[model samples]
Target chain A: MQPYNYPSKYLENAVEEFAKLPGIGRRTALRLVLHLLNKPKEEVEQFSATLNEMVQNIHFCSICHNISDNDICSICSSTSRDKTTICVVETIKDVMSIENTMQYKGLYHVLGGVINPMEGVGPADLNIESLVNRLKSNDINEVIMALSATTEGDTTNFYIYKKIKDYNIVVTTLARGVAFGNELEYTDEITLGRALLNRVKFNNSFSVE
Target chain B: MQPYNYPSKYLENAVEEFAKLPGIGRRTALRLVLHLLNKPKEEVEQFSATLNEMVQNIHFCSICHNISDNDICSICSSTSRDKTTICVVETIKDVMSIENTMQYKGLYHVLGGVINPMEGVGPADLNIESLVNRLKSNDINEVIMALSATTEGDTTNFYIYKKIKDYNIVVTTLARGVAFGNELEYTDEITLGRALLNRVKFNNSFSVE
Candidate 1:
């Protein structure tokens, strides 16, 4: 595509800034900027104000390091949540992904990132120390490593496991198997093998046998 | 999809604002907000500031109705451009698309939008009067209707043609034809028929004979 030559410097600058976002290209950025331009003046101002306010006022949970309005997150302060189990994750996004499942009622401990030597992210760089302090101070009965299925995730999980191995608690990881609704034909060999290795007993609940 | 429940209200508000943009869903909005959260405070501040500044300060070209930094646009003010010819388009985005083509060296007239009765848009609502005033005051030789191929585009084209029929200037439109690089098998009947009816003289540039 030809180099963009927007009519206004402000439009060009705005497009440039929006283009810096992940997965957004110049064309899409221009489209978005034009959409903003068409919006009412107050609405655009409100949009801008919302972002600034969020960035300035947002807080990280003091206990779990998740994004929060207050020092402690809602889940951490809620008495109804399972206080004995803490799910150790790579980032705040993982916590949200798990929460969306509506399955787990336990608390979360965001590591901020995984241990990746290539990226120069070490165990010390993450919120691992804060997690250790939480474990030491609390009567937590279970610690679940809910990181991704990547090498960095595995390394981070192992390091955290070592740090909390002395504790009189059950340490577990997410079950590795064929995902629900996933066809075996499309499953990779390693995942298929793992699914077979950790196969669960067949319980035909739908059958009237 | 599960209902989103971000840890922070600020995060939720920011995501909501971003989700209002075209094609951005709640999930994508959340991802973008989280990405913003990860950026440096100064960078995010700059992003917010840039948007506000653009919305507050951006100008529209008085001559062509395109988005402009100053009173007149570059194309309209440039000395080398063909001032005798004007390509009328539907929006500022259309002007940018023509500019990107690097084809037509003529000036432009942005209608802001085409006539769409179904959407309550009419000639009176657009910059048609301004265009007529420009024609009456200036010595323009030709006017090209470069609007879309939709029914609204055709209606606006005929309306404009009728408005300028009494004027001494020649009026034209973008030729309706089968587009270049389109496969014959997939070409729609009307377009293919139009292409056949308006077939150009054969040129032998590629043949050895």
Candidate 2:
């Protein structure tokens, strides 16, 4: 390689690392690298420190599995929220979507991922066991399954519905206002609100108990 | 204020800092912040260490004024490059532009910036004096002015041209193919290649000795 007069190995490595992020291409990565190089040394240092610190500080809360730095997430620990009603979601992004509406006064439980058999993500692969355990231990009255409208999402909802039906807790799914195969993450407030408004109770088919 | 579950003030501060980067809005910044959270503890430490190492390792070359991990840059130290010719540029990005073509095999001198009266950039503001001193001390045959075609760029070129003309050195500009008022960073290869090939010798009133 022709010798680069200005060689910044750290910048080169950091750019390579940044290019691995979703939606960040090579040219954009290079532009970012150049921009970082131009920044005051203190600012660049702070940027890197911030990235590392954020990663080290935040983690999945044990109670709700939502991203948090504490043992229990903010939503899970809050007394203001309806603790008896749990809004279950596939990811933290879905939680944010629901939270943005300022309508969800209920607590949350993140499933971590949807049950996709094709992707080898069965009920066992998700945090479904923990959710079931939480329902058994807590005084949860209603369990709302706010998963995506996809085939996998349906499969996960049914699986969850069968497990929790034995309990007196009312298991409800979001209304069919969401488009078929559309993820809950992409759904807007209006559609999500409609879905929430028209939720139906799911009957337990497997559990005769 | 909403209770942010992620309690580390330093971590939160860093995330806020990274959120200021171009194209990185708040949501994406949160994603990155979460991604860092998922990384192994050692890997997170390594990322921080890398940034600190970069700051400690990199330094500006005293001769060509290019960033390097050494006192003298690789281009300046290399015996293979054309030493008789020095390609003078506004920034390190300009140097990369010329290097990317793989056409120019000469040494370089980075002026840091061009003369912009509006930006308060004058002859003394740039690294012009060092460049002039280099010409006076060395047996330099040609000094190619690869500045932008902006009004400010032209002013800087005129100022540098006068000083270099006093020495018995051939001073040239990077041709008129570059569009008027355009920055060198955006010029395409074909246009830049044609410009380099069609470079005209400066024949101003103040002729070279």
Candidate 3:
């Protein structure tokens, strides 16, 4: 079937706007617009107002390059976090993911994106300079690379490794292995090999006690 | 992993609002909010303004209950459409789907929803009365039920059938069978039985010259 041409220009415009969002198709956009039409005027107003306020006021953390309402993000400014150990990640989402784990209490350095030659993203395009500057000025002891398990992530890690190797800071990568609760038979060979090679002590694997 | 608590109230509020939409998770909502943050101020303004304008000003067609910018929708007002044949659908989305097919040139009667007892929706809750009124006022000869293939749809069709049976109107339901490109072996029993029982003339099935 061909696409339905909406009769009302207002409905069409609303659907078009909704469709601009990531992963939202025209059919889904129409459903969302119609749902808004059924809601109270005040609620619709609140939804739009909240989005507008976010877009207009939201800023990035000056220190970590993470999303924030001010110059410095809460994580960056927090006194409890281990500022000497900075976990370098690709995007703000990565920062949120690591924060969710509650396993990493260190500060973050968002690179915005990984170095992908195909996408024209290079070390120069990332926040590498700021990271180097942070290393040069601050008393950082460790730099943990918590990037994705991909070629781009590896490339970015290597690039950053070469840059900070001369600064006398310990550089490390996230441990590669089968995820918790994953079946050993279903796990890929590379991950299984790595997990075996860098096997942690059984007592150190759990904090339940 | 626990969720990362957003620093900005505005950002959190926006993400929460986006998450309110059907099928959108908190992660997807955050992505959408971040995408808006990256967009230019004017584009975001336009997105909100369009939704606001639609919710504030959009109206439904008085005759058919279809979404419209005015009292009468284009389909309802169109002189070329066969007003005598009214296609009864559950929602505006159905109308759009039928229109997209470009096979039916008849008018439409939007019932808004089926008689879903589980959800507390009944005949009184839908726009059924208006449809009956339209039949009474107009020279409508046929009323085609274009509802979803569900028990609720069947219940609604039966209910409406009882209401207008004595009015000398020809009431019909959509054909049920295996869909195009579907393998006969995989077709369900009820649909396959219906297809076999209501087999059409061989000559009428093909449009190939």
Candidate 4:
């Protein structure tokens, strides 16, 4: 094929960058770039500015490790939310998923990552220490481990449980709304619902209540 | 829905901003925001930078009106490309589609938009004057109208034909590779090919080839 004669090398460069986005292929990326080119100057400017603003403005809430524009996330700062109970999640997406159900009003503590030795991630790499610290100082009554039901998730859950056992907090996990081997990100609302409903006690080993 | 306890109001604000994308709805925008949140900090930073760079660096080629970072677009600047023939397209995406096939060797002239009365776009608003000027000065021989086969596209074509009739240049349009009312943006490669091959000569008041 002949080399492409893009209007701007930078436009082409941007297309290449967009191509790296999940689910975007080369042709689609090119199409998107061309579409952007056809747009009025102000529209393209807004599109670019929005992306830039998102990155420059948004940040992780230091307390819950959830996304925020400030030091303390909205949920953590809200006086109405139950502060004594913290729902543990592997990622911020999981927090959104749980929030979507409108079932949980407790606080959240994002692990940022799970314990996956295969990926070179260990216990020390996660936000486990912060969670333990929260349990130690606060009147936290329960810790709901709402991680995915994958082997990696189970390992991470167990690891966190061990670290937090010394604290007299009631530790529970989301009932099995997730199917085996599925990541929390991909699990549908129904399955996640079932898993949450079926959550059994974490008695050093995983078993249905 | 209950007020989404998004980690941050800024995150919610960003999600609202993304929701304004052409085809994205609130849910999809939210999904995209969560996806970006999950990305590594460096990747997110790079994504933000890419948008800024694209907006700040990209420009339209003065000659062909194609998007570019320089005074001339790549196609317009290249020595190998046929500068004598200009392919008139409704949008820049049409240019890429034609370029990808490696069949057309001519430079491009992005109209920026098609004539659509419903949308309040008309001839006076288009870059028709520059096109007429290009024909007057350049060694341009043939002007191929590769606009979509929609009523709006036809309206733009006829309007352009009237303006350029006095220039004594060959005027041709994409032989109907697209179906009636189907946007050029949606036409697949094969159909576009068939249409390109079947293009015919166009005139304002006569069907003369």
Candidate 5:
């Protein structure tokens, strides 16, 4: 397809910048940039300034490698969280997902990325060393591997498990089973099999009696 | 759903700004903002700066009201373009679409937007006055209404038609029919009917033998 030539060089530049965003194509970029043009001057300024300030000021948590406004993240600083348990995740996004669940009260250690050999990412490339150091230094009891189900996530989890195996802490992976509201028939074979093997006794008290 | 509380305030701000975009949801915005965090500092600077510079420097063409880096757009300044004809479009996107076809040699008059009463947009909101002024001053013979097929587009077309009916200029709209590759069975009723009503004579000379 012939690239839609923007009437203005400025519009073209804006569209190009927008297209750099993940999942945004050139046409969608154009549409977005045009929408910005229709917005008030202050609104557009705020939009650009927000990004600029974020890029300039944002820093990774010194302890867990999660993004933070300060050197130490809010979760790391909070005394109420389960300091003994550290949920290891691939990125800050996973940390947010777990936090939103409101089920896990433990602290987090963001790996920044999983070990993907195809992408030239290895154990050394991640924040694994700091995690190992945290386990050695802190009075931690458990380390939960909350990575994705992909090969890269598995590889990263295995690498971390090997590194921290010598420590006195218990290392565990997130359970592989049929998710809540998911039908057993549609569940993947491995997940369904795991769910069946680890089946819990039906509790009458927990049911709507 | 509870908004994913980003660890960093800066990250939150960036995500908020991204979510302000036309079709972007909060989750997608977070993904994009997080992607920017992974990019190099200089690359992020370029992305923001590109938008900032574009917003600050962009202007509208004095004659046609199309977006321009300069006072006069490239099409308006070009000696080769047919000045006698002007294609009236609802937005700069339409102008780009037509220009990409490379079939029309006419200049364009971007309306910025069509009349939509429900959206509180009317003739006063558009660049209709300047278009009428152009018809009066310039030796333009024909005006092509390249607006969309929506009710708003039709409203805008009729409104403009009434405005320029007495100006001794030929006014026309884009052809309505089934698209070139579309099957007749799948074609919408109005388009198929219009195509039939405006049927052209078959010419063997123009066809492949």
Candidate 6:
């Protein structure tokens, strides 16, 4: 590993900060930092100021735990949204993803994260208690678990199910089957098997009218 | 072109700012901004603060135009560096790339960018005047044009050559060759032809002792 010969301390510090991001490596970080140097001084200042403003002023929705500008998120407060159905998701990104489909209109309950024992995350660390409280007092008819297909996701879903099973509300999980655009021959055996066993009528399968 | 339903204005603004950077798309920008929300608040503050510090305080070397902490960069002020030679490059990143090679110890003259008529960047937009002034005042013995292998690079090199052709100094360009570790079968015609025409002595080809 040959050492970098950065010409200035300020440039080096900026690169190190960018490299701390999730997928940005040192070289990409250096490239991004240098790009900022070429931008207008006011633009760069605005970039930093905006980041600071986000970290300082951003809030988490009290009802759903989604990142928000106020105590309640836009989805949670909207009058037109389906208040009877609640979708349990892992993060705010998932909420946006579901919203992009223009399919689901129900309000969301963000769990912050799933149960991953290896990472020391458990039900207590999530928003499970608040979720249970919401179900206890609200007229919610169904709770849909929209987690990933990983083992951790299953474990989290099972744990949440146990906590809310006694309630009169219906509990369901996202459909597991062959995905659209994926060839049937290339689909994993488990997914293909599930798709076959839970096949919907041909007319109901397609999204086109 | 579906509209994004970002829950918070701050998050949306941050994503827009991150997307403005080179190579970063809107989806990647959202992921990165969410990643920052997970990091400790102090860490996020430090990240923004470092960026602000860089844009406000970083300087360009008065002698070489390279980025520096002071008016005179460390390379220009060093006693052990070879002051009789100058490597003319296009940007600070190029300066670091050459420095990382551990081969060249000469000072650099950053041209900011190559001559590109399409972008309206001309010779006057670069640091050619400062380089000329340095050549006039110093006892330089060689000038290396280490620009890219493009029409713009060649135009810049030829333009610089014309400016200092009468000086008592050697003007050289980097040898064009097939990149190390690249298969010759896949090398492009122009590069392969250049490699053959400009083949180096076998004894001086590699870095191994």
lDDT of each: 0.90, 0.78, 0.89, 0.79, 0.89, 0.93
Model 6: pairs clashing at backbone N, Cα or C within 3 Å: none
In model 4, where do residues sit more than 4 Å from their true spots? A1-4, A31-59, A177-209, B1-3, B31-50, B177-209
What's model 6's TM-score?
0.97
For A14-117, candidate 3 gives per-residue lDDT tens digits of 99999998888898899998888878989999998987887788888999898898989998899999989999999888887788776888999999899999
lDDT string, candidate 4, A24-82, tens digits: 66666777666665557677666655655676778778888888778788789999999
lDDT of 1 at A124: 85
Minimum summed lDDT over a 10-residue window in model 6 chain B is located at B200-209
Writing each residue's lDDT as its tens digit, candidate 6 over B59-80 gives: 9999999999999999999999
lDDT of 5 by residue, A1-209 (tens): 78887788788888888888889999999999989888877788888788888889998889998898889999999999999999999889999999988888999999888998898987889899999999999999999999998888887888888888999899999877778799877888988888889876689324534
Looking at model 3, give its docking quality level: medium
Worst 10 residues of 1 chain A by lDDT: A200-209
**Compared with the true structure, what per-residue lDDT tens digits does model 3 show for residues B122-171?**
89999999989998888989999999899999999999999999889999
Q: Is candidate 3 or candidate 4 better by TM-score?
A: 3
How many clashing residue pairs appear in each of the predictions shown? 0, 2, 0, 12, 0, 0
Query: Which tens-of-lDDT digit does each residue in B25-107 have in candidate 1?
Result: 99888888889999998898899899999988988889999998778888889999999999999999888888887878999
Q: Would you estimate the TM-scores of all the predictions? A: 0.94, 0.78, 0.93, 0.74, 0.95, 0.97
Model 2 docking category: acceptable
| lDDT tens digits, residue span A103-170, model 2 | 67998888988988777877777889899999999999999999997888888889899989999999
Q: Pick by DockQ: which candidate is best? A: 6
Q: Best-fitting candidate, measured by lDDT?
A: 6
Cα distance off (Å), candidate 4, residue A2: 8.9
lDDT per residue as tens, model 4, B72-182:
877888999988899998676678779877778998888878988898888877788899899999888899998887778888889999989888889998655576689
Error of 5 at A185 (Å): 2.5
Cα distance off (Å), candidate 5, residue A136 = 0.9
Give me the overall lDDT of model 4: 0.79
TM-score (chain B only), all candidates: 0.95, 0.77, 0.97, 0.82, 0.95, 0.95
